[model samples]
Target: MSTLSKIEPTDATEPVAEVLAEVKKALGAVPNMAKTMAHSPALVRGWLALSGALSVGVIPAPVREQLALATAEYNDCEYCLSAHSFIGSKVAKLDPDEIERARHADSADPHAAALLALSDAIARGRGIVEDAALETARAAGVTDAEIAEVVGNLALNILTNYFNILADTDNEFPPVTPLAHA
Candidate 1:
């Protein structure tokens, strides 16, 4: 059970209601995470702005989804792990094995592997990426613009991961396999 109450569209204030409508239109339904975020209209708006902008950014959708999966796994956020796994497979066309590899921040594609490494480094290093890591990403063909976008995507996923953990947000998407940490 979530500690925070989700703001339903019909019950939302003007600003929140508007944002919920947009979320509904885009996703075909209001995700639990978005609804939980709607508890604060400002948060919902800020989330939507950043997420909407990133959706059209340089990084392709699959890469973005993979990065999210890797971040969620590192952060140990069950809600995001489940949500992104579903989105990655269904919307981003990532296969099961690909999704598993993404959770480990490894990819078969050289370029994608580099980006995932950077994403993992950002999460593990708390955003203080080393010069060598940046060089690896650059050598893998990630441009300065793409690097910036990857950082943005990392931040975005971190926000949701932290939110879900803090709020104990219910999983609305298909369940993903739980991580086994030894």
Candidate 2:
């Protein structure tokens, strides 16, 4: 059971219903996170607005999902871990290894690897990363816009991760367990 009310599409009304429909239209399903967030229409709208903005960001969908996976693992949010794992592989077309590597904020591609490393630093440093982290990302071909988008994506993931953990949101996606990192 969730700490918060989990609104189902059938039970939703008015603003919540409209937003949930939009979510379903876009995603083909209303995820449990959105259903839980429907408890507050403002939260749903705020999340959608930010998410819509970031969809066109320089980070790309795969990398954005990678950051979300990394953030979910960092926070140990099972709901998000499972959800992103599904979205990462199914929607973003990332391979299983890439999805796993993302949890550790790693990637084989140098550009993605740099961003993931910066993501790891951001998570570990609590957003107070060292200068060299940014420098390294820049050196690896990350742009200023990419850095900004990474932070934006990180913030978005943290919002969902914390919300799901706080709400104890039931997992609506396939289960994914966290692995011990080296």
Candidate 3:
């Protein structure tokens, strides 16, 4: 159970109802994160807009999922870890080993590994990654645009992770334990 109650689409009035509809359309079902965010129409709309925008960005789906997984683990947000774990496997077709490795911001691919390490540096350093880390990623072939996309994706995941942690949102996806994956 969440600290905040989940609002069902049917029970939502005007503005919120419309937002929830969009969420359902985008996700195929209304997950708890959206339901909780439905309390504020703007929050839900902003989240959806950013998510939609980033979906087509330069970063591929697999790496984006990796970013989500890495951030979720960093922030210790179980809801996000679980959600991304399921999405990473089902939607992004990440293998179990890949998924697990991503939780540590690691990948066998040098480019992905570099990006994940950069992400962790950004998170750990409070959005201020060292020049060396950026250089490392650049050396790994992560483009400036891809680096920018990483920040964007990190912001998107952090919003949900912080929101879910604060709201204690129920996990609708398969349960993923941070300790086990960590």
TM-score of each: 0.94, 0.94, 0.96
lDDT of each: 0.89, 0.89, 0.92
**Candidate 1 per-residue lDDT over residues 73-175, each given as its tens digit:** 9888889999999999999999988899999999988888999999888878888989999999999998988889989999999999999999988888877
- TM-score, cand. 3: 0.96
- Model 3 Cα shift for residue 19 (angstroms): 0.4
Q: Write the per-residue lDDT of candidate 3 for residues 130-155, one digit (tens) a residue.
A: 89999889999989999898899989
User: Which residue pairs clash in candidate 2?
Assistant: none
Instruction: Judge candidate 1 at residue 130 and give its lDDT.
Output: 95
In terms of lDDT, the best-performing candidate is 3
Decreasing TM-score order of the candidates: 3, 2, 1
lDDT head-to-head 1 vs 3, winner: 3
**Candidate that beats the other on lDDT, 2 or 3, i.e. the better one:** 3
Q: Which residue window of length 10 is worst by lDDT in model 3?
A: 173-182
Instruction: Give the runs in model 2 whose Cα sits over 4 Å from its true position.
Output: 180-182
lDDT tens per residue, model 2, 1-182: 77998899998889889989988986688888899999788898889889999997777899888999999999888889999999999999999999999988998789999998998898788889999999999999999998888888888999999999999999978988766432
